[model samples]
Target: MNAVTNPHILVVDDDPDLRDLLATYLGANGFAVASAGDGAAMWVAFNERLPNAIVLDLMLPGEDGLSLTRALRAKSSVPILMLSARGEELDRVIGLEVGADDYLAKPFGPRELLARLRALLRRSHVLEAESAAAAAPPRFGPFALDTLGHRLLRGGQEVALTSADYELLVALVAHPNRVLSRDTLVDMLRGYERDPFDRSIDNRVTRLRRKIEPEPAAPVFIRTVRGEGYLFNPRGGQP
Candidate 1:
């Protein structure tokens, strides 16, 4: 890890000793590290400033890791990698289902964890660079998403976008009118192998529409393709 590319990572766990250890180890590896002892502390720290990625523990004091992960997924698209005890396969699977990007069982080597975190950050950067601009930006209704700027504007007014929603919308507009399966969208946006059973992609699309659609329930820019997936309608819901 290069000091110049100091990716900030938030470590959330209940154990004070382990939190300190992760901070020291990750910082030594060119990461700007922040640690929290439980879910409440995690929220306080995150609300203050978001990190590039989050390393969450499965066992927290009150709101457990799975619950916290699910809650965070509701609004944020920040990458999450969960840490659990060895033999916690069930916890690992559930973690993924709840929108955790990856999982590592405890008793793991610091080097291995570092490598995994680096890979996750790399993938996220790739996605951020996925949809570059052409001569003219693509338009969906009044909203025009600028891949180069990573910003959205509607009627010359800027639209608020979460990281997840921005990436999801870019993928859709880049392939207008084509039905993209949830798996394809997940793989493209997440920068990882598609978790076939994961519904997080759909969740993201829902959030994106609320920002870009006139009526989120009857979205014109992004249409649900029923069994297939979703397709972008360029004509949009023009009055």
Candidate 2:
């Protein structure tokens, strides 16, 4: 995908009116828009042609956003922005936990949604460029990260990771031996503005450490720098 070109977006919502509105608005803003009414349609659309990002609605007739998110996480790491009614913080958290990058409460304006989508797509492009620039795989501690394939290998064995986790690890490894603040990691990993008091970044780092660290409690690869932040020790040499 060209950096200047518009992105392809999949909007999944059971509400026909809202789905149409989103498609129209996104199309007007120069995005190639695709719409799906439910998870089955979402799967078909994804299989036929993968979108750059997904706008998923939490409430659906069948196979709700959370289920679809989990299902998608099992295969693809496409960026997902979840939609929910106001006061559904639990659903938002679950969506994030299941691998959705961001969420927006409903009754939102088209402009706001477009802005969020653009931010995410822009971040995705940046990450892609960074990965492309790294010709060889990078090794840090027990993990060997294939930048091109976006796969992680631990102790010479492949380990599964969510897109968000891989991006967070890349961001940390990019500035090896340097501390990355939680706020910075949140912004880079979430592909959007960081929210105050959001614990998602910490949770993702913890999960990643569990997969790559010999002891997640006393992580050597990703170390806490006290008042600073987390550091990715490149003791294993850069690949």
Candidate 3:
């Protein structure tokens, strides 16, 4: 998500009434609003212009909210507030696990939504400011990996990245062109305590590739070495 003076918020829900309510309320509260009926529409709106934050409902006609959340989080760090009609504990947990920044049950007030949106934007602003203040970020292709800022920039525009993604990127860029084993990467990631069956390193790699690679399917930057782990190529193309 790039910096904008008037924060844009995208609301994804099947309920036309709810969408109207939010558009009116958020617009009145000084926010630019976009509405999408489902995951397909959400993507169209997203690709057209990335929103500062997304309010995604849990249930949709196809590709439920959790799936959408995971897909979005894999590439972008846009703040997501998931809404579920069920209000089940499992649903909330799953939503957050899939990368929702916050969750709200159905029948929520517009004012509360506005408040949560503001909070997310506030946090995002602080992050942007920190990234802007950082000196001498490393360049790779069209990207500048801001180690101090804990973010990534492409052509001077901020590309949203999670802390875990940033850490993984830092490790990879620090040892460019070297294949680092998964175990080594797991150890390098600070505060990442793992289970015996944990494969978060691989997951993080996939997520990172989606953001940085021109073609994730045939990655040019981060290459997977058969039986060896992964290698980051700062210059891109074959290692």
Candidate 4:
């Protein structure tokens, strides 16, 4: 792929050897790679050339990965994959909660890291395409979505949403009148499987329904499917 089309990834790690290794592997695997040693350098590289995804280290010289993640999330929805050392499950969870889409512990295999990176990049691209598709004045219930501009309107008033929430909404709305299982939704939104007990998808859907449905308690636009999952009922809703 051309440089413009190739997914650009920023690898930010204090370890030069690891950084170079990641850059080399990612570059060889159809991605354009940029490297930075610390948070300041990461910001510099970010300003110079915005990457499609960031592989950020949890431990940095000045600003740490979590801080950087919060900072970036405040402005942009660029995909972030955090890298932490072994035995840092707390850090991993915090990373996810703070808008980092994925995390990998150190001493990880190059292949596994590559797989995770590819999965994240693939999900990002899918979301972009879905956003473009949803922007074309599509209607469901009292809600109208402008996918291109990433805005939702309810009763002609705009409704705010986070990146994750918007993506889940698009996935459901795009396939209205169908039952989407929790696992399916997870795959659609997260680009991977989760543990059976992981409830992120359910939580996101609940939050989305509250915003879009006039009565979140008895959601009309998004309905539960019992043992199956959830469905968007657009038959009686505005088109």
Candidate 5:
């Protein structure tokens, strides 16, 4: 988190212009940037010096981004943000399924990409510090919130969570068993503002339920009020 020590990020994209643009853009934003055109070049840079994170393009030649992601995940826990021209829901879901920390579609704003990278790096740094200090995560509902580690666990096993899911869960758990309004949850997420009739909050709650609740259809942990927002029921299970 030191301004003096710029975080190194490797940008893997086949497009030369995109690579140069990202390198220039990210470099000005206080990040040490490296560029790779394909999977082979990515390894070359990785071997030269492992980066704090990787911005991988999903449509690489021969070995695609997902393949590299699966292969790298088996060896390293370094945070990865997958990029793809395909912005479908299925694509995003698949990317997260293969251990990606986050996903971004093509033609995204430089600022947005920078924000996502910073969040991922920040989470990684926090987890490393917590592990070194032997810190215990907050516990509730048969789950331990590894806030710094950015993953939930129950019965000493890792629980999968995407970046968005983890952030929302953390916000809810911080004020456990309390009714948090949609507006308040939106502020916590820092997401884009929506119309008055927005169901963004409900959508997020549904996603969280599928992951944490034993029965998503009849969710016991995250309960919804008819007119109000959702509440985190600590009755999920004994901590």
Candidate 6:
């Protein structure tokens, strides 16, 4: 269960029946539920009140799920779980690549949806708590981690960070100049169960490098230490 009380969830789908069902089920399960029929409606609901998490459908009219996901990711780090009727692997990959945190195929059980949603919420809440628990906000290079606000600021401008990105960066910043292995990072971030070949950590590193490093192609802030793992260079000159 999420530690946050009555976390609001926005459900965006064209199917009115499905929308009502999810709203009812999620509301019954202690979530504040809001429903939207399409992309326009979703945006209206989103602007009126930002949701704790979003349940987006892939095949919405006007703006598709991938497009909406990209737009949302550009603005906020809110967790998004995308739903699609087609269970194709390519679709799932595309969805994830476009910034959907999790993907679910149609014909899924309500219990399974609840479980996945809960897991995402749990991770998000844990990240917030960790930030709030920090004794003092950490600073590195041109960035200042606003632990109390749960935000990353560079030159007073807030930088958008996903839950995974924020958690990974927090872990790296906490232990500067140390080579952290993939397994160690996964454990530290409380990452979802991943296969042996999962490159989630590496992907997150690339994303963070793009955001913070002077040269992402040759990163100085986050250096790859050969076969060991990654090392954070807080001073950020030569890695």
Each model's total of backbone clashes: 0, 0, 0, 1, 0, 0
Colliding residue pairs in candidate 2: none
Candidate 6 per-residue lDDT over residues 1-239, each given as its tens digit: 12578989999999999999999999899999999998999999999999999999999989999999999999998999999999999999999999998899997888878877876876676566565546777788999888777789999999999877888887787667888898767655654455667778899999989989988998889999999999998999843
Candidate 4 is scored at a TM of 0.61
lDDT of 6: 0.86
Which pairs clash in model 1? none
- Across 136-225, the per-residue lDDT of candidate 5 in tens digits comes to 677766888776677899998988888888877876665568787886676556533346567777888888899889889988888887
Residue pairs that clash (backbone atoms under 3 angstroms), model 3: none
lDDT of 1 by residue, 144-170 (tens): 777678789988888989877777877
Ten contiguous residues minimizing lDDT sum, candidate 5: 125-134
TM-score of 6: 0.59
Estimated TM-score for each candidate: 0.56, 0.59, 0.56, 0.61, 0.59, 0.59
- Candidate 3 vs candidate 5: the TM-score winner is 5
Top lDDT prediction, candidate number: 6
Best by TM-score: 4
Better model by lDDT: candidate 5 vs candidate 6: 6
Candidate 1 off by > 4 Å:
1-4, 131-239
lDDT of 4 by residue, 1-239 (tens): 11126888999999999998988888888889999999889889999998999999998989999999999999888999888885467877889999999988887999988867766865676566565565366787667888767778877788999988888877776677889888767766766546768888788988887787777888888889899999888754445
Worst 10-residue lDDT window for candidate 4 reads: 1-10
lDDT of each: 0.81, 0.81, 0.83, 0.81, 0.81, 0.86
Clashes of 5: 0
- Candidate 5 matches the true fold with a TM-score of 0.59
lDDT of prediction 2: 0.81
